[model samples]
Target: MQPNQHLRILTISSMLMLVLSIYMVFVYAPLEIVMGAVQRVFYYHVASGWIGALAFLITLICSILYLATRNLKWDHVALSSVEIGVVFTSMNIVSGSVWARPIWNTWWTWDPRLTTATIMWLLYAAYLMLRQSLENPQRRRTFAAVYGIVAFVSVPLTFAAIRIWRTIHPVIIGSSDPSAEGNFEMTPPMRNAFFFSLFTFTFLYVTLLWHRIRLEQLTVQVAAMQSRLLNKLST
Candidate 1:
């Protein structure tokens, strides 16, 4: 297939899967008895959370490649991954807030998971800003790679801290037992919807990452061309 044809096919498939996932979430998935419509937010919430983590992991991997090869393509991948990860993670945090408002009785809380997510968001924010401060593209890429590795190491630790904290304030739900508040037993359909959403979002992430990396490559090419033209004119 031609490159444009292949790109079009991937775009169409990504969009179709996204639409199906949305349909499953709103139409087929049953409303939680306790949280009602609010619990439905968990579909996007968890999916975004998963994708965000995956993006950071990819960023770390791309960082390794950049350091090993000093290739600008790896830098583009690393930068795009972090940027896209930030976008999805931001959505995850906001959707978590929407769900938490009714269920947790607040829009924001100091809970471990919530707090760690916020920190992860800020760390990437700083990473991006650090990249912006450098004038040299090579230096920016190397610096960002180092930061990516450091930032990724903290993701698991943040999760572990939050999980441990949630153990104390856990609420009981969907069970006669008092210790199971957040645990909603899923019907088969709901399970299907949840997993389907996850699969769809993973594909969506892949599509977006590809597009973003392409954009970065184009931007770099334009920059190099402009520099060459200026040098020619100066000579």
Candidate 2:
């Protein structure tokens, strides 16, 4: 199939899955006895957080490949992944803050998990800024790959902050510390909804990544064509 046709299919599928996930989150999932409707946010919030980490992992892998092969294609993939990662991480942070307002009684906190997440987002944001500062394509790609690899250290740290230290953040999937707040038991339907939301987000991520990669490819082609046009005009 043509590239446009494939993108169209992906767009349709992602939209359908998104709609289903929203319904599952709001209507199908059982309401929490304590948190009520606000708890529903947990489904997409956790999923977006997971996707953010996954995007960083993709960047890390692409960075490694670019460093080893010095391939521009890998650099493009790494850049696209980091761009997507930043957006998803921003979503995760915003949703967490929204959820925190009612549960933690404040919109912001210096809790371990929240603190590390903010730092991680800043690190990646800096990575983008670093790329913008460099003009030489080779140097830019090299520095970006190195920075991307180094920045990934924050992802694991952010994930483990809650587990390693005492925090008010809730642990949903695994063994929870006694001090963990906002923790709740999930019913069967809730579990199903949670997993479905996760799958939906993963699918969405793949679709977005594909589109972003294509955009990067088109950008390179346009740049090359422009360079050729300038050279011909100078002659």
Against the true structure, whose TM-score is highest?
2
lDDT per prediction?
A: 0.82, 0.93
Q: Which stretches of candidate 1 lie over 4 Å from their true place?
A: 1-3, 167-181
Worst 10 residues of 1 by lDDT: 168-177
lDDT (Cα, tens digit) per residue for candidate 1, span 1-235: 1156666778899999989998999999988886688778888888898888999999999999999999888989999999999999999999878877776677887766677889999999898999999998778888999999999966786556534554322322222324324556778888899899999999988889988888897888888899999999999
Candidate with the greatest lDDT versus the true structure: 2
Question: What TM-score do all the candidates reach, one by one?
Answer: 0.92, 0.97
lDDT of 2 by residue, 1-235 (tens): 1379888899899999999999999889988999878899899899999999999999999999999999888998899989998998999999999999998899999999999999999999999999999999999999999999999999999999989998999889887778877899999999999999999999999999989999999989999999999999999
Q: In model 2, where do residues sit more than 4 Å from their true spots?
A: 1-3
C-alpha lDDT of residue 130 in model 2? 99
Among residues 3 or more apart in sequence or in different chains, the pairs in candidate 1 whose N, CA or C atoms overlap within 3 Å are 171-181, 172-180, 172-181, 173-180, 173-181
RMSD of 1: 3.0
Clashes of 2: 0
